[model samples]
Target: MIVSEGQLIQSGDPLLKVDFKNVKDNVPSIVTPIVFTSLIGREVTLEKSGFQRAGSNNMISIKK
Candidate 1:
């Protein structure tokens, strides 16, 4: 995960940077939690560091 557990995140903070192609292919299933949370508020302390996939796609997960 870009931000570790208990790290405070502020608005405009980068959560994850993804390739447009990969996200375009899997938009229905992909979810960016940090980005969403930032949109609703100015900051948040992460409860989990979440997960990240290795290799080309590099998918990130917050809860699952």
Candidate 2:
């Protein structure tokens, strides 16, 4: 899904594709309770943020 039929992709172009088969459909909901319990009370702060450029596009980068 990263590139369209006629689209171009270059080096470092971020491409992520996820396939959801029936076997994997319930994974998130099953794991959410266990994961959320540890994060019930917490403070998260984003410390650094910037953009990385490739070709004519700028992609945002964030760090904790």
| After superposition, candidate 1 runs with Cα above 4 Å error | 26-64
Worst 10 residues of 1 by lDDT: 55-64
Query: Residue-wise lDDT of candidate 2 within 1-64, one digit each (tens)?
Result: 7767656777577655555465377575422111222343564443333433335333322233
Q: List model 1 lDDT by residue over 16-64, tens digit each.
A: 6678688879777665553444335344445445565543232433341
lDDT at residue 16 of model 2 (Cα atoms)? 51
Best candidate (score: lDDT): 1
Evaluated at residue 63, the lDDT of candidate 1 is 43
